[model samples]
Target: MRGVVVAAALLLAAAGAAQAGPDLGNWRVDAASDGQVTASLYATNKLITGNGALGYSPVLTLACRPDGEPRWSEWLQLNDAVSASRKITMSVMVDGTSKFDESWSVGPRGKLLVREGDDGIKRLVSANRLLLSWRFGLLSGRGEADFDLAGLSEAVGQIAASCNTDPP
Candidate 1:
């Protein structure tokens, strides 16, 4: 019994240490093998429905690859699966200002892939907040998420450095 208690204490400590890894504001950076790093931040506000139903907070993820084309891939992971994998126009607002309605692709597992370009990334790094509104037809319904972009620059810098690529 004493040995078991000691082991349990050690496990708890280890778990705590793991959770204490590097974080910049609401963003969490994770390093994977082969010079890959990912930074993720959850939306500060939940998606509320017209009928007063609340949905889970969406996650914005930035993944850096050392030897992949484009080097970086940005994803908005929705709580529910998208109806289909197709092009959709998403309304974007940065810092409460209307940005643009960009065409985004719904990748596998309902992940919306941000268009590959410097414009989108530039806005993200320089803004304090991001709001995305999309209509996923009747099946998936409409979705809106507001993300807090604090410390996003630092998180991107860390991942860029790890992958030896320029921050996008």
Candidate 2:
């Protein structure tokens, strides 16, 4: 069941990127019959520019299930191409308003992404909109990704319901 949900999330993300322009156009939610939900945020070069080869595209995947808390993961196509310093700073803007500003160390292989945990996930799911910006020093540039929270509220509610709990 978990594998199916994960595959669905990946499929939704890939299809969305092909359909959605480079902007915040690739937000989607997948709810599985087994009470699992996955939300994906995919950004293309059109939305995240200036990273040279390192920022071709990045995808954020959040998976939630009735038996456990949400889990987050990020994949960058050019992770190996990024030569930036290990430390990177990222900021989240909610509806044009600043919300989270923090820094994390990119792993040696450049695979690490800042984890916002349950509180941050709740905040994002509740926001009307949001933007994520990150500085990639190796590229001597930064990239921005946006998200539209149009259907997120209901999606989150449904995900919470799967656990027999209220939306966090």
Best by lDDT: 1
Q: Which has the greatest TM-score?
A: 1
Give the per-residue lDDT digits (tens) of candidate 1, residues 1-168.
Answer: 999999999999999998785557889889887777889999887865435566678888888888868777777887566565777788899999856798888887665656554457776897898998888666657788888888889888988888888888
Candidate 2 CA-lDDT value: 0.58
lDDT of each: 0.79, 0.58
Write one digit per residue (lDDT tens) for candidate 2, span 1-168: 999999999999999888663233355667778776666665533433444443334655555666654443232233432345566677878878756786644655665454534666667666776677776555456666665666666655555565566666
After superposing candidate 2, which stretches have Cα over 4 Å from the reference? 1-26, 31-36, 44-57, 65-87, 104-108, 163-165
Candidate 2 lDDT at 42 equals 55
lDDT of 1: 0.79
